[model samples]
Target: MSILYVLLTTFGVIFLESFLVALGNLRFLFLLNVSLFNKINWKHLLSLSVLSSLILDVIYHYVLGTNLLMVAVPLLIMMGISLAVPLENSLPGYSVKFVCIFLYYLFVAFVPNLILTGQGTVITGVMLGGMVLKAAISVLFCVAFDIVWSRLRKKEEGTKLRSL
Candidate 1:
């Protein structure tokens, strides 16, 4: 059931990102899910990341390996953070999530634009602003999910206690 949950959310992110213009190539949804939800095992998260990036690449018509490289770097960083740092529904955790999402935007949007357009390229205000907005939105969404999940867990615990 947890595997199914992970797969659904990961693929749902990929689907929205691939088809929706507003998503703007940012994988924050997936990043936040994997970072916050320890239920997703490492192996499944890794495979899903690789698969999603490839699918995004094909959908967006990028060079085959570009998305994989961009997506993998931040994913590894997030995985390390999730493992080493005890992130919960707190300020530090939220800050880390925002930073990770920002870095993901940098890698997915800025770096590729830099590489493709060469050193003479400028990142433009619109792109940077969009990244910030997306990151903020992702953080907010994570917080909301945490609240709902906590409520559900509490209700379940209460029910178990009553049964006892």
Candidate 2:
């Protein structure tokens, strides 16, 4: 099924990235609660990812005039990464989410395109527009996912307390 493929690919990419970052001594993986991702309501994330991918596909096709898998796949990857990682308290602000999305897009989307396809361009005005759009979508989806996660987590906690 397509859902299985997406989950497999997303997890594979996340695992590989975490491994490489560990090898590189980046320690970025410490920011995440890995178990939370597996436990969190995945159906919500999956639905959002698919919707975001389709919307991005249309945008890229119509606006950029390029069928760039690089753009879309990385968006999905970001969705996974967002779910995996928790924001630090010091960085607690709305801007931090956008920053996370922007960095993810830059490193995951742009750098790979440069290395693999030999295509590199400065983040220009037009590219910034697209980046902003991507970040907006990421923030929106992240917030929605968090809302559902919090509600579900609270309900579970309440049930546990009641059982005691």
Candidate 3:
């Protein structure tokens, strides 16, 4: 995809999350993972991912040091994983990609915040049950995306078969 489209999609998703989820920033990590799995060159995807994160940091006005770490850490992990797995092939399937992407989103979203901002408040009695509410928005949207992507993929396959 063109860089402009990539950037627009990334920002659109980010805006959608911020508007809908009220600080839920899973979209960046989600897009980073998806773009990498598009079977494009890892270097290009990595650059775009980092650039997107940097743009986010700018928007949020995060401190220079922590902001840099926030972007760099995930990029490092992505590099490590790509090194171990063959990049020439796309991710095995959407389910596998979703799981990995979800886990990576957790790490990317929470860990750095913990490090830079310190451990958050205890999940005292009542708060413990609210975890589902916290996650439901992102998960539901992901399921919606899965439906859309799968339909698009099927259509693409049909067209390719017709062409053949």
lDDT of 1 at 34: 43
What does candidate 3's lDDT look like per residue over 9-121, in tens digits?
66764576466446643444454344434444555556556665666666665544444464455445555666666433243333333444444544544555676587643
Model 2: per-residue Cα lDDT over 61-140, one tens digit each: 33331223434443455455556564421234335556655655555445545654688756777766666776666565
Quantify all predictions' global Cα lDDT against the true fold: 0.66, 0.46, 0.50
Considering every candidate listed, which one attains the maximal lDDT? 1
For each candidate, what TM-score against the reference? 0.69, 0.41, 0.51
Candidate 3 local Cα displacement, residue 36, angstroms? 7.8
Winner on lDDT (1 vs 3): 1
Q: What is the C-alpha RMSD of each candidate to the true structure, in Å?
A: 4.8, 12.5, 6.1
Give the per-residue lDDT of model 1 (tens digit) for 1-164: 75686578668867677555454545643554444455435666666666666677777677666777876676567768867666677887787778777777777665665556664345678988988987887788788877766655554452222232
Model 2 residue 63 CA deviation (Å) reads 26
Q: Which ten residues in a row have the lowest lDDT in candidate 3?
A: 155-164
> Which stretches of candidate 2 lie above 4 Å from their native place?
1-91, 117-119, 155-164
Clash-forming residue pairs, model 1? none
Candidates sorted on TM-score, descending: 1, 3, 2
Which is the better candidate, 1 or 2, if ranked by lDDT? Answer: 1
